[model samples]
Target: MPSAPPPVPPPQPISDLPHLTRSPPLPDFFLAALSLFVFLSSSSSRSFKLPLLCIQSNPRRFLKTPSMSFSHPNSGRTPHDAHRLHPFASPQSLSDWLKPRLPSDSFASWGVKPGTKNVHNLWLELSEGETSLADSTPPIRTVQVLSLRIIDNHRRILLESHQQLSDGTLRNRNRPLSEKMKPNETPESAVYRAVKEELGSILGDSDCSEIVKIVPDSYKMKIEERNSASYPGLPACYVLHSMDVLVEGLPKEDFCTVEEEEYANSEESSIADEAVSVKKHFWKWVSLDSLDF
Candidate 1:
């Protein structure tokens, strides 16, 4: 008799990670709706197809401990405003609003004629109450222009954005940018400068890595006005920008966060460093396939 070979380790659960794939939307939304229903109704965390409408390609999910909040490259929005958004606007409608007519109530696409602030607001809402996320406060607008960089485990290109983080989180960065410097510049331009100063590489230079896209990833935000002395702007905007990319070399300590203090930094209460900055959210880049969509 012969002995059997050693068994292999189980595959990693991609359910909490995002993947890179360019696949067609499951057969028409109509047919997918049936599958969507069961997926949502079932106890399993996997996303369903249509009616339940849980279509996310990446599966990695983060709990958003204070260190993560992003925004569109425009005037920011309020938490009440996010929760108060009109129900008529579907994800498709919201995505459409970004391209053309970004209304006041919605965040319009960035770099557009009038503005796309609110059009991007609804975009943030789509990521709320998702499979693995806990209930979060409404999103907030950032006061400065932001520049976001995405890199793979090898520091390869992923995605980028020009929007800024709200003042509350700006102070959470490895190094804070001069908020007063770019008073009139657009967020994209402002971000480009900031990235250069912090990381010491010009993104637009011929030597820089090519950026895939700059998307205004929407996620729900929770906010409340406070009488705190720190956040000059008492009621600051909080946001989470979801960048799709490939990157590496991110040590958790390279970034700063107030996960232990956000809930307590209210009007009557106080947080030590009143000013929190966010140069990076420090994402855990697992293969998109690790996500269980």
Candidate 2:
């Protein structure tokens, strides 16, 4: 009469911070549907996963905060026009659409190409209601954190700090590249901007593209609770996103020459400086095994 051991207990709901694992491949439509459900049901404070159909190793590059607003990257098209061009049903038509067909004028109007930008937008659209839900609750703070990974041939990683260079190796040195998210900027875009600011002259247009291999997933998400000096009394939640970056075309020695020859103060310098300027920072490469816990 024990009711068959309480029917084996209902499966527990997935934890807000689920174990980090490679998400398995799922049907595109099913994945989309699941993402929509999570977005609509969860509060803004909670971290949710959007279906990542594209799998890659080293997917843990978690993008930090900023209330994301999705729009077309290409110019000349209104948001509505962009939406019309890239309807969910059309791009996801894994059947006929995937097959090549004769070119037609209609093809040109199909909208902006699917990339990181719109994919984020799609997540927003699914979870649009969460914003209102959040409005009803006590306010939660948002922070955007950007990080850069500089690795050497021995597989050691570089750690940077703004602290005095004399602090020595005992003190914690954070990964050098980090910045708050700017208005209407994506995490990856923001990271690139910071890179240019930090090492533009040395990098010399060499885009960092090679990423290390890790569990494959669409996006990396992490949530933590902590207190900071700026807002000591108030409790806080931290959302973190990080990615490994490898710069192509960098020479093995003398990363880049910094010429002391100063340019004359002129109109060109003023204009050029506005776009990109060197930032002051320090770097130290440490072996992965040598990190003091």
Q: What are the TM-scores, per candidate, against the unseen true structure?
A: 0.23, 0.37
**Which whole-number lDDT from 0 to 100 does residue 164 have in model 1?**
30
Candidate 1 has its poorest 10 consecutive residues by lDDT at: 127-136
**Model 1 lDDT tens row, 126-146:** 222111112222222233223
lDDT of 2: 0.40
After superposition, the stretches of candidate 2 with alpha carbons farther than 4 Å from their true spots are: 1-66, 70-140, 163-173, 204-219, 229-236, 249-279, 291-293
lDDT of 2 by residue, 206-253 (tens): 654332222233234466666422222223455555555555444454
| lDDT score for residue 154 of model 2 | 71
Q: Which stretches of candidate 1 lie over 4 Å from their true place?
A: 1-142, 145-149, 153-181, 201-233, 238-293
Quantify all predictions' global Cα lDDT against the true fold.
Answer: 0.33, 0.40
Provide C-alpha RMSD values for all models, in order: 27.2, 26.2
| Leading candidate by lDDT | 2
Model 2 CA RMSD to the hidden true structure, in angstroms: 26.2
Tell me the lDDT of model 2 at 128: 22
